[model samples]
Target chain A: MTGFELPVALFLLANLAASLWRVLRGPGDANRLLAALLFGSTGVGILALLAFSQTPAATPLLDVALTLALLAAITAIAFAQRAWQRGTDPKRADD
Target chain B: MTSALAFDLLLAALLLLSAWQAMRTPHLGRALLAFVVFGLLMALAWARLDAPDIALAEAAVGAGLSGVLLFDAWRAIRNKPDSGKNAGDEA
Candidate 1:
């Protein structure tokens, strides 16, 4: 990897670190969930960078990134399903 | 070069800070968020260390799946009858 790659990676890492503030100081669960989404996106970025910095054999890493993106969305959906279940349905309660 | 080393050190320090936040946060929602953020940072660190496979896994399993689980739990709690005023207000 070139010297440039490391600095760029580090810069991304720093931003990830800054995002932790939302997680720690969350007044609500949604904030934490948002942080999780950020993690998925940033992780993909880091992985892509690492793969690119490596030999041409880094193709497998791209697959891994794709898997991550898919799973992240699924997870969000699953959580929403569970959270909005029958007993907990806010709309019902409001009615 | 020396600059690379500096970058690594800075990243490591930030990771540590985020990790601490994830573990120590008082509110459940906030704590979950912190942990997710921590996972993302960990993924970035892995990439920096030249392990793209690990970065991807961490991003998906650690951050994504775990985040969903946490949010599900939060929602369950938020909807509980015992949640009462807070739940009503928050909702």
Candidate 2:
């Protein structure tokens, strides 16, 4: 890795560490969910950077980032839909 | 310590802290949030370890998918009639 890459990646990791507190101490699920979302974007960034720095085939790694970005949104949407369904489904047997 | 090592150490500490909270918190909502945060931190950790492939997978599968699943579960539980009766209990 380049001289600068190491430090940049390290700083990103440190910030991620701080974010952990919010996940642990959040008052509600909304906070936690947002934290997880934050992770998705951050991970993509860190991965893209590392890929470009360390690997020759950095192009494919970008696909991973793109997939992550797309999937993260899908996950949030799916959860919202399920939650809405559960909220509206009065007849859910298990409750 | 070198900057990289210091960063790694900080990431490690935070990962442990968040994981602990995610697993141990009494409030389900807070626990879920912690879990999501933990996943993200884990992705970072993987990147630091020089495994971008794993990092990407962790971000997409672990953080993205798991966070949604946990929140969905929380919402379902919260919306239950009995849950309303015990709404005062945040846990």
Candidate 3:
């Protein structure tokens, strides 16, 4: 079991790197925000994998991941709304 | 020993990616986004190191909550004019 654990962990670790690359190299503003959302999802995956590798009980990490997802969604929406507000402001354009 | 070595390699790669991105990015919004991503990735690395509680805190508070805050800051920064004091502060 311990032997199998390391391999799974490594696989997830690699995925995190890929996601980080997306966040860094995303084409523009919207793409970067989208990539960041993907990054949060991967964080959830990493937590689930960690629980499997280290503990019999996965409830704690499951709870944490769920909370993070909810909060992240709300935050993203709020920022989107604010971003919309900026383009409409006339004074913000010249300076 | 092999497992530990693998862990070390993974950690090293994460550090390299994040450091390079942090150093080179000119945009505050992108840099802050990268920092949050780095924190989330590091939290998982901590879990791999056998630290569950730390991982929970890092994911929920360090990475997730902080990501929200920075995204909001980015909204404010990018939405403003050049003369706007809130624009373009580095992450």
Candidate 4:
């Protein structure tokens, strides 16, 4: 809508792509979870960017962001816990 | 016009670089550290983008809460025997 919003949109998209790459290329569940967390947080940031450009004065976006942030943590914990419970394979697949 | 865009772009690049490095690092311990840095820098980026309130929330949750969660997860997993073999394997 204004000069600032365009680049914000592009940055969010670029980071999202980057996070997706990590999600796919990750060697382990921890790596994938890391990417997933970053990916989700960036999405929340896009929402914040929307709030900033469109509302400009509202404070509710912070609430939304806080909620997303907590959820990301919960997801990370769940994934990492699964990784732990499943027992890591110290051996390569070829072996 | 171009300067602001350039600066913002730099911040975004910083965010991506730190995040990717964190995920790519072989040592899970180091990766957790990188995540903390990413959290802090991203919070600053929020301020650069003219969102102080978001910056505050980001710094608190992103940096503080996420950092703690990462370390807790790291502690939960690192002492286990298999992280050594888990580094580069596709899972």
Note each model's CA RMSD in angstroms. 5.5, 6.2, 5.2, 10.9
TM-score of each: 0.67, 0.71, 0.72, 0.43
Task: Supply DockQ values for each candidate.
Answer: 0.41, 0.36, 0.40, 0.05
Clashing pairs in 2: A23-B34, A32-B33
| True A-B contacts kept by model 3 | 0.48
Distance from true location, Cα of B88 in model 1, Å = 14
Error of 2 at A86 (Å): 14
What tens-digit string does per-residue lDDT give for candidate 3 at B1-91?
Answer: 5865786687778867886776677766666766766676667666666676787787777676776677676676665678455454322
Comparison by DockQ, 2 against 4, better one: 2
Query: Top DockQ: which candidate number?
Result: 1
- lDDT (CA) per prediction: 0.63, 0.64, 0.64, 0.60
Q: Which lDDT tens digits does candidate 4 get at residues B9-33?
A: 7667767877887888765644664
Which residues of candidate 3, in runs, are more than 4 Å off? A1-3, A55-59, A83-95, B1-4, B82-91
- Candidate 1's residue-wise lDDT over B65-85, tens digit each? 887777777776676777645
Residue A88 displacement (Å), model 2: 16
Candidate 2 residue lDDT tens string, A2-91: 557657767776666566565455443444446546666776776676566553545656766787778767766665465433223344
DockQ, prediction 2? 0.36
Interface RMSD of each: 4.4, 4.4, 3.9, 10.0
| Candidate number with greatest TM-score | 3
**What pairs collide in candidate 3?**
A95-B81, A95-B82
